[model samples]
Target: MKACISRWASEPFRVFFPLGMLAAIAGVMMWPLLYTGKLGFYPGEAHSRVMIEGFMGAFVIGFLGTAFPRLTGNASWSCGELVWMILLWATTVASALNGQVLVADTVFATLLLLLSSGMIGRWACGNRDTPPPGFVMALAGILGGALAAGLLAWNQKYPLGFTSYQFAKLWLNQGFLLLPLMGIAPYLLPRFFGMESGHSFHDSPTPPPGWWPRFTASVICALLIAAGFALEAFGWSLVGHVLRATVILAWFASETPVFRRGKLSCTPGNVARFAVVALILGTAAAGLWPLARVGSLHLFFAAGLGLAVLAVATRVVLGHGGRHDLLVGRIVWLRIAAGLLVLAAATRMTSDFVPAVRVSHHIYAAWIWAAGGSVWLIFVSRYLGRGEEEPS
Candidate 1:
């Protein structure tokens, strides 16, 4: 048991990815339980909290914890750090499950602080390579998450004014996830599409001459994204949405091979492309149909960010496990999972637009999302610790 855990600790993703998937399952399951009268509370806030802070947050921790150390040539997360982080994550999930939003958010803030401190510590003092320039946005996203959590916890104790509340929600729902996804995509997605990423690390201790300029660009983009969120919070929804979407599209086009035809078009890469489309469309839809904003945002949450995270997680697991063959091919299970998520997003949107069928559609969407998460988890979990070992 000790040896098995040591191996898992060596690669944080081996543990946290599965935990994130399970949190996603649990988060979506709340709706079904509520509509069926199995749950006593409405679970709206709790569901959102769990999905963002518990589900998405776990992936952030896993991927960054696993990748950051290597990126900076620092040590991997110690076993103690891994254990404490997992415990805190589990507590946050449990608190959210019990409808303790304040508790959940507070715990989640602490977790983010812990994660940020470790990564920042490595970046500041460690030897070897610098992280990608886009990581400036990634760091901003992490800090945004912590701030969002703190705001939420405070709101639970004292009512934030309507604008303040909206700002908090926007930061939590869109800013935290969107920033990190865009930040990481430039550095990671090119590889998925069989294109060379220009952000590769060098052997020299000092960063290359042009690194700071790229970092400055990332900082400017991050500020633009935050400004967009502020605009939305101040009731300029359409302007904000358009600005955010345009910034993301422009950044993606500049930083990634998103517009170019890559040599490869595999499952993860294809899904990632779909995610980008969904993200832009969904953001625009939220502005275009304010009355159905809830449903439109599902496209961003369930299909856009959710699918993107799974796709990246899939590639990470397969690549690390030496299952290069799987990465190049269309994995049938992943296709099914992606299809299910799309359906769930559509169903959720339909529920918002058509009031008569809202309850039933909500239940259906929840179950569909849960089913999709299960399919993804089942497929990826098999390769977790199997590194380079052929399946029997």
Candidate 2:
């Protein structure tokens, strides 16, 4: 038992990635149960927390724990770091399950802060190479999430009279999740497309000539997102989100040429690209149609977050396990999963637009969401623990 615990604890991704998927799957499943009056309590806020912070948070933790050391050329995270992560992750999940939002947020904030500190320390001590802009954005996103979590915890304690939950929500949803995505996607998407260094087999993308252009673009993107969120907080919801979504769409539009470069079939690369489009569009939809925000929000979850997680998780599992072929292969099931998620997103969005079909749509969306996660776990989980690249 000790050995088993030690094994999982040492490998952050191995322990957290599957758990994250499970949480996401369970969260989706619960939504339908809530709608059907089958469940006594439906912690909608808690459900969002688990899906976004819990599910994506786990993947982020695992990825950072695995990748940060490599990028910084720093020593692998200590056993102490892994142990703390496990303890905190377990506690946070428990708190979330029990509807202890404050507790979960506080723990998550601490974890983010700790991880950020470690990475910053390593950057300070290690070689003087300028870090990737995407990486910088990601670190900033982590800190931003920490601040949001801290604020949420404070609100719980001090009882800030006004409703600031939306602010916290935006910060986590856009600032924490989107900014880092902007930073990393440029670098990773190219690799996924087999466009890096104009070669397919290279494990990493060839760094762009002079990171300044990408850095400048990243900074602008972050500023636009931040501004949009700020506007939303200040009661300019439509204007703010429209502006934000426009920027995202424009930025993504700029990347369309890359997608056009090759056969745009049902490949993982296209799935990822589609995920980006869905994310931007969903964000815009949420802003434009306020009444349909719930539906649009689920669209973001199912197509945006859900599909992207599937793509990246598969890549990590395969790349790390020395099975890049399977990772990049034209796997039919992967396409089917992506299609199901798209269906889920459509069902969710329509739930708001058409009242008559709401209940049925919710049920459809929930099952489709669960199906997507199930496909991933069945196929991808097997490869996750195969690699011991990260040290124990």
Candidate 3:
């Protein structure tokens, strides 16, 4: 028992946790949107989103624990922090899932508040190599906690002085989840195409193939996303438009090095190439702005999240695992899987936009999401076995 506990306390467990969380996220995404006709579960939209929120909290904890050492030259965080953080996350997830259990829900929400605040406070001492845009982003975790608190209010006749439409709903949605993700996400963006990562696979800071100015451009992309999401939440819709446009440009700019180097045909290389195209098309859709309607958001997700993020996560995992010394093997199919996810998202998007498509939304969403989830799982396994070439 002691031996098992000791083994579990180490890095492999840490790695596996995020994989599990990501899988859960994919499952939550794919889960059927059924209805009991009850106010809460009728469309089941909130249920899925809340579950995704749980996965996000897990990702944040895992990300911070994994990345902080690389960035700050600190020792990996102690086991105690992991226990506390994960427990808090679990509680928060439970609270969201079972809002009727008022005591459990309230306790869990408070735990999230405490844990998230502690995370920001601990990282308060961190100094940045770049301008540290992620710092403010990370601080938004406290806001997420507040959102969790808002969720708990469903039990108390909704009498917390925060109405669902007002402070409880929209602000919490944007402030808590989207904003802090902005910080850690910059570190995460490059992985989709087997690029440089802090994942301990590639020797430290060695630039990936097919790129000259990937680093600078990646920073710009991250900043654009941060500003876009933040301004959108703050109700500065025009500013959101400008920031999103900047993201489109930055996305294209980041890929210039890849296109120039011309390895653009290899499996992983092609994924990055395709991602750039997706972004370009996505940006054109964005040109429609509010006139663009929800269909445009689907295009954005399909292109940006599905194509780009899929490439980033898989590629980063591969590079960090050290799988591509001569060349990273055929991971392009994974991107295809991601594209399938986009296809699924696009279906729902079409339904949202065109009344004719609404009837098939649930079934369409599930299949595409399953494909995306499966491919990501494949990457996780591939990296675990043979991905890491050298320890940094």
In candidate 2, which residue pairs get closer than 3 Å at backbone N, Cα or C atoms, i.e. clash?
none
Clashes of each: 0, 0, 12
**In model 2, which range of ten residues has the least summed lDDT?**
197-206
lDDT (Cα, tens digit) per residue for candidate 1, span 1-392: 88777766668999999999899999999988988789989899999988998899889888988888888888888788989999999999999999999999899988988988988988888867788888878888988888888888999989898888888788877888888888889889999888888665565567787787878888999999888889998989999989988887888888888777888989888888888888888888988899999899999899999889988999989988879889986999999999999999999999889999999999899999999999999988878878766562
lDDT values, one for every candidate: 0.88, 0.75, 0.49
Output the TM-score of candidate 1. 0.97
Ranking of predictions according to TM-score: 1, 2, 3
State TM-scores per candidate.
Answer: 0.97, 0.89, 0.64
Candidate 2 error regions (>4 Å) = 1-11, 35-38, 161-165, 197-209, 253-258, 263-266, 388-392
lDDT of 3 by residue, 138-204 (tens): 5554455455554745536655543333344433433354444434444444343345533112222
lDDT at position 314, candidate 2: 72
lDDT of 2 at 74: 62
Give the C-alpha lDDT of model 1: 0.88
Ranked by lDDT, the better of candidates 2 and 3 is 2
**Distance from true location, Cα of 291 in model 1, Å:** 0.5
Error of 1 at 318 (Å): 0.4
Summed over model 1, clashes come to: 0
Give candidate 2's whole-model lDDT: 0.75
